[model samples]
Target: MSKSNPVVIAVGGNSLISEKEKVTVEDQYEAIRGTVRHVADVIEAGRQVCVTHGNGPQVGFILRRSEIARKVAGMHPVPLASCVADTQGAIGWQIQQALSNELRRRGLGATHRGMAVSVVTQVLVDVDDPGFVDPDKFVGEVYQEADLPVLREEYPHWVLKPDRGRGWRRVVPSPKPLEIVELPVIRSLLEQGFNVVAVGGGGVPVVRGDDGELRGVAAVIDKDLATGLLATTLGADLLVVSTSVPKVSLNYGTPDQTDLADVTAQEMRTYLAQGHFPPGSMGPKIAAAIDFLAKGGKEVIITCPDNLKNALESGGGTRITP
Candidate 1:
C-alpha cells in the first residue's frame, strides 16, 4: 500500500451532539470518545493528522448557560466572540484528552503523554465582508411566534430570522476566514509529532486593526471553510471533512438522491453551481473542497465518523480530486 498523505480533518458539530437529548457535557464527551478512536486509527496507520472541529451547538450551550445565569444569579452575558473562544477551548480539551487516551490504550504510550494540545486559534476575516451587511447565520435558542414580541422587546439589537421549519433564531454574520493567526505554532506542534487541535468553532473571528493588531469580531466563521484555508496554508496533501453523512449526495433528501464518489473538481463544481448543496448544509463544505483542490491539494474526502477508517484506507467516501 502507498503512504497516506498528510491530512487535515474537519469534524462537524454532529460528531459531538447527535440528538437534543444528549446535549450534556458528559454526553458530548462520550461522543468525542467514539470519534477520537477513528482519529487514532489514522495516526496508527502512519498518517500525519491535524484536526479542526465545529462548535455551533457547543457555543449555543454556553450562551444559553450565561443567559440563564444572568436571569437567575445576576451575571453578565458573554460576548459572541468570547463564546466562540470558550467553546474552542472546551471542545479542544475534550478532543485532545480523548485522542490521548485512545493513543495510550492502543499502546502508543509515548504519543499519549502530553503529545496532544489545543491551540486557541484566531482567524482573520475581512471587516467589510458581505456577511456583516446582511447577517444570516442562525445562532442561540429558537423562539415561538408567540414569543416574538417579547423577544424583540427584550433584545432589540438581535437580528431574528425564521429558521425554515424551526422557529425564529438570532442571526449573526458568518464571515469568510482569510488567515490563521497561529499557523507557525500549529506547524511546530505537527513537526514535533503532536496531535494539534486548532481553529475550533472556525476560530474566534478577528479583524486586523489600524495598528496591525488583531481585534475580535462578533461573527462565526464556517469551520469547514477555515479548515480548507488551514489545509492550503499548511500545504496538506488531503482535506477530510467528517460531517453527519457518510457521503456527499446529489438532490439530497429526495427519492432520487444519488451519492457521488471519485469525482473531479470540475464535476463537483458543476453540481455545486446547480444548487445541489445548500448554504446551510453541504454548500460551504463543497466550496471548501473545491478551494483546497484548486490550491494544489491532492484530494478532499467527505465522510462521517463511522466510515473514517474506510474512507482513509479504501476510498469509501466522496472523493474530490484536482
Candidate 2:
C-alpha cells in the first residue's frame, strides 16, 4: 500500500448520519468534519485523494421535504435525479469545506498551496437498465408495518420494503453507472494537487439521448459501483470504500460469520456467487472491489471511515487485490 499513489475514497451515506436523533443538518456537518479529519491525515501521508460519497440518507431527507411541501402547499414534487444532484452539491459542499478547513488547520491549505473542490458530477447510465423496472435501492424514512397501506394509498408508485430489521422504507431504482462525464475534470483537479469530492449519490444519474445529448434520469447509481468505475477510469492505485463496517465478511451476521482481512478478486467473486454478501449490504462493495481490481486497480480496501488511516497502514480492513 503505497501512500504516494492516487486513492479514491468512497464515503458511505451512513457516515453522515450519526444517530437517528441526530439527522439535523448541523449534525451532518459536524459528522463530515470528523470524517474529513481522517481524510486530511491520508493527504498528509502523501496520497492524492479523489472522493465519492453516498447520498441515500440526504436524498431521502430532500425527497421527504419535497413530498411534504407537495401535499401541504400544493407544490410540485422534485424528481429523483434532481434530489440526487441536490445532495451532491449539498454534501459535496460540506465535505469540500470541511476538508479545506482541516487542511488549513494542519497548515496544508492556501498557505501551503493545498486546496479542495467539489464537482457537481453526472454519471451516464443505460436508459434500458432492468433496475428501473425493479427499484432495489432503499431510501427515505422507514415506516411502521401499519403504515404500509396508507403509504401505498398516498404514493402508489413507491415500492416499500423492510430494511433488514429496521423498518419498511421506500426503495428506488439504482442503475449501474456506465461512465462519468466529468472524469477529465476530476483528473485535472488531482493533477493540480487539489482534493476533489465528486460523484455524490453515484452521481446524478443520466442517460444519453439519440442525438448524444445527456439528460437526468429517475434513478440512483450505487456510489461504490460508481467509485469503482471512477477509480479504474482515473487509473487510481487504490479504491478505499468507507462503509459502516471495518471489514468484509463471509456469511455476515450468522453463527459461522467470518471477517475477511485480505483476499484476491477471484476469491471475493466466489464468495459473492455463494450468496455470502447480500445485495442490500456488502454485495455491491464486494462487486465494486472485484470490478476495480479486474479493471487494473492495484487494490481495494473496504473499511469504516474511522479505520481509514489504519486501513491505509494495512493494520486493518479488508484488502482485495487482483
Candidate 3:
C-alpha cells in the first residue's frame, strides 16, 4: 500500500497490557508507547494510518477504581457506558500523543503527516439487540474467593463469571455495532490531512431511544467489528489488526496447528465455521477480516504489535485477501 491508500490499524486494548507486566497507568502508557513506535514505522514507510484501539483492560481499571471509591468515600459509581467513554478518551489520547511524539522523534515535522487526532467515537447499537438481555462481554477486575461475598452482595446486578479458576470477573453485553455516529466527522478529519484515531473500545456502545435521542448503554462493543466497519466505511484498502499473536493458526493450541502466512477470506471463513477460532479471542478478528473483504477491502493483516511493520513489508503475518 502507498501513502495514497490509507490503512486502518486496529490495536487491541488487552494487547496493550500483558499480565506479566506491571498494570499501572504509567506502565500502560509505556506499553502503548512501545506499540506506537511500530505504527510510526508504517507512517515512515509512506503510508497514511488511521488507528483504532481496544480498551478492555483500561476500562476494567476504571471500573475497579470506581468500585473502590464508591465503597470507601461514598462516591457515585461511574456508569458502564461512562467507563467505556473514559477509557476511549484516555487510551485514544495516549495513542494520539504517542504517535505524534514518535513521528517527531523520527524527524517527521509536526505537519509532515503527523498531526494525529483522536475522536471520542460513538457507535450505535440496536436497543432490541439480544446481547443486552444476555450480557457476556467481560469487564472489571477478577475477585478472589475472599472478596466474592462482598462483591456479590454489593453489586448484585453484575454478571460474574469464573476466569479459568483465576477468579470471578464481571461480564457485560457485547452488542454488535450497527453504525458509527461519528463516521462523518472522522471522514472529515481524514480528508483534512490528519491521521485519525477513532472508535476506542468499540465507540462507547450507545443505542437510540424511542424518543429519537441517542443514549449511552451498559454494553461493550467488539473493537475489531467496529474497526472493520470503519475500514469499510472509510474505503481503506488495508485493515491491520495488531493483536497478541504473530500469525493466525488452524487447530490452534493443538498438535496439528498450522500458522497461516497468507490465506483468502473464504478459507478463513471455512476455519471459523469449523471452530478453529473461539468467540473470546481470534474469532472476532477473523470475522472482521471476512466482513472487510466482503465489503471490498483489499487485504487484512493479522499479527502482534511488534510484527506490524514487517507484516506489511514482507507479509510477516497472516495476510487475508479477498
Candidate 4:
C-alpha cells in the first residue's frame, strides 16, 4: 500500500500556450507557472499528485521545426517517435521546475519544495491495434496548396489531409496504450511522497518485438486514455481532467447546451453513444472517466486549471461518479 494516495491530473498541451498568437517560450513558461500555482494549492492542503500532460500543440511545434530544418539546412528528418520524446522532456521540465518554484514560494518544507520529478515514461501498445489501419491523429506542419506536390514527394508514406479549412497536415495512427514501462518507478516515487510528472504525450507509444525487445513506434496515443490507465494502476481514487472548459456540456456550442455538474458513468456512456461528445474534443475525456470509474476510481473532475480548487471544494466543475 502507498503511504500517500495521489490525485492524477491530466492537463491539455494547448493549455501551455494560452493563445494562438502568443507561442513563444516565455509565454509557455508563464502559462505553466500559473498552472503550477493551482497544483501547489492542492499540495498545500496535504494531498499528493501525479501530473500527466498532453503534447498536441507542442508536438506540432517540433514537427514543424523538423520540417523547416530539413528544407533549409539539409538536416536529417526527425521521426514521429522522436518528436514524442522531445515534447515529453520539454513539457515535463516546465511542469516540474514550475511546481518546485511554487512549492518554495509557499514556504513549504524541504520535501515539498523539491519533490517534483519528471519521468520520460514509455507506454506499451499492441502490435495489431486497428488504429494502424486508418491513421487519424493530426500532427502539425500544415502546408499550403502549392506545397502539396513537394510534401507528397518528400513524405510518400505520410497520410495527409485537409485540416478543417486551415491547411493540410500529416495524420498518424493513435493506438491504444497497453502498459506503462516505468509504472514501478512512478509508484515508488509516489509512495515516497514525491510528486511525479509522467506519461507525457501518452508515454512515447512503444511496442514489443517477437524477441521480447521494446521498440518505439511511429504513432500517437490519446493522453486522457493513457492518464486513466495510469490512475487505475497507481490506485488513485480521483482523476482530474484539466481542459479549456470549466465543465462538460451537452449539445456544446448550441442553444440547447446544458452544463453537467454531477453525472453518473452510465449517463455519460449514453450521452457518448448519442454523440454528445465529439471525438476530437470531449469524447476521449468521457471515455476516460467511464473507464476509470469502471476500474474502481471513485470520482472524476473535469474543469479548467483556474477552477481546480473550486471543483474540489465547492463543486465548480463537472463531476463524474460511478
Query: What would the per-residue lDDT of candidate 3 be over residues 1-322, giving only the tens digit for each residue?
Result: 1224479999998878866568887888899999999998988998888999988778777888987898799898899889888888888888888889988888885673876899999999988889878877777777787887887787788788888888887888888888999988888777776788899988988888879899998888999999999999889999999988899999888899999998999999999999999998999999999999999999999999999988999879999999
Quality of model 4 by C-alpha lDDT: 0.91
Judging by TM-score, tell me the better candidate of 1 and 4: 4
Worst 10 residues of 2 by lDDT: 1-10
- Model 1 lDDT tens row, 1-322: 2222358999998679867899889999999999988988898887778899999888888888887887799787788999999889999999999998888888785752335789999999999999999999888887788988976776788788899979988899999999999998888788777778999989999999899988898899999899999999998988999999999999899999999989999999999999999988899999999999999999999999989999989989999999
Backbone clashes, each candidate: 0, 0, 1, 0
The alpha-carbon deviation from the true structure for residue 228 of candidate 2, after best TM-score superposition, in angstroms, is 0.4
User: What is the Cα-based TM-score of model 3?
Assistant: 0.91
Candidate 1 TM-score to native = 0.92
Question: Could you tell me the TM-score of candidate 4?
Answer: 0.95
Among all windows of 10 consecutive residues in model 3, the one with the lowest summed lDDT is: 1-10
lDDT values, one for every candidate: 0.88, 0.86, 0.88, 0.91
Candidate 4 structure quality by residue, lDDT tens digits, 191-288 = 88889999998989999999999999889999999999999998899999999999999999999999999999999999999999999999999999
lDDT of 3 at 153: 83
Comparing 1 and 3 on lDDT, the stronger one: 1
lDDT of 4 at 270: 100
